[model samples]
Target: MFSDFIELIGAFVLVLAILQISSDRLFFSVKVYALQSFFVALSIFVIGLYSSSNDLYISAFLTLLIKVIIIPFTLFEAIKEMKIKREIETYINITNSLMIISSIIIISFILTRYIDLGGEIISKKIFPISLSIIFVGAFIMVSRKKPITQLIGFLTLENGIMLAATSVTYGMPLIVEIGIFFDVIVGATMATIIIHHINETVDDIDERTVENFEE
Candidate 1:
């Protein structure tokens, strides 16, 4: 019953996450994004319990610490620094986004069916959701214009990738996990710098248009 609950929670979180990505409000989306990571952390911990893997449990703790806590705080700070409004302008309509997301979910399930996952019980069941989450994350990054939103999207995708890897492999080696986290830290730092440049490049559409015309 406990494992089943965890499994359901994981799937539910993924759904909320994708919806949050499609939202037109920036702060609300970020809040939902953090909520998604929290549920992911919980799911990881629950997976550790079911698998009886110490490494998974540790990884879950770190996932909670880094993803749920530290990363969100960092992102919030970035958002404040940018002083951007909470209003988001989406190029695509919400209904179309929902349809596309549904299609991605179907595609994920179909693709997951072809591969034989590790000999784990839960991994196979969760695999489709994991893949969907990744695709959704990537979709969020490219679909939005704001760089901050793009960073959030990328991190959300990272959460899915980590969930997929750890859930499938019972967690990677300690060294590998550390290296991956380090790389993520570096990536976030670099992304912030790029966002600063993007903000400076064109604060308004007319400036952007002039720059484009000049090119």
Candidate 2:
């Protein structure tokens, strides 16, 4: 039962990532990120329940508090304030994006097949998914033209790393987890401010325009 839940949560998070990259709507992507973060937190909580790890419990709580709730709320509010609705363009079309994402997943599975991390057997199962999430998140950062969409991609990448750490090692040191959370919160807040500034300075927050800037 425990292993089954682990696989299920990991798979669902991967599906959400696929969904996010396939969509052009910025708000929709942000909502998808929030859902993905929720699953990451849930996975930690489930693992903690089975392992009786207090650190995992606290880590799960922080994930819920920061990733699922606060960050999303802040981004959503920032978007509302900016009155931005959707991504102006994606460098890769949806059809090609799906193809690339599929290829990334297959390659991840192939790459991690024989490697062993010496943690839970389930960690081996999740390793490829975590790796794929990291790659796909990076792809998201590059393939989307909007800064906000890239920010969402960055956050997704972080969630993938967190998922791997929580599942593989069972949990990191409590203080380390807390420090990571602090860094993420600070980074997210700063990124949001930058995005807002971009929106204010330009008619559209498109990356293409950024390259054309005189400076």
TM per model? Answer: 0.85, 0.93
The RMSD (Cα, Å) of candidate 1 is 2.9
Tell me the lDDT of candidate 1.
0.74
Residue 38's lDDT within candidate 1 is 82
Cα lDDT tens digits, model 2, 61-139, are 9999999899999998987887754454677898999999999999999999988676346556788898999998999
Off by over 4 Å in 2: 85-88, 119-121, 203-215
lDDT values, one for every candidate: 0.74, 0.86
**Cα RMSD, each candidate:** 2.9, 1.9
Among these predictions, the greatest lDDT belongs to: 2
Q: What is residue 42's positional error in candidate 1, in angstroms?
A: 1.1
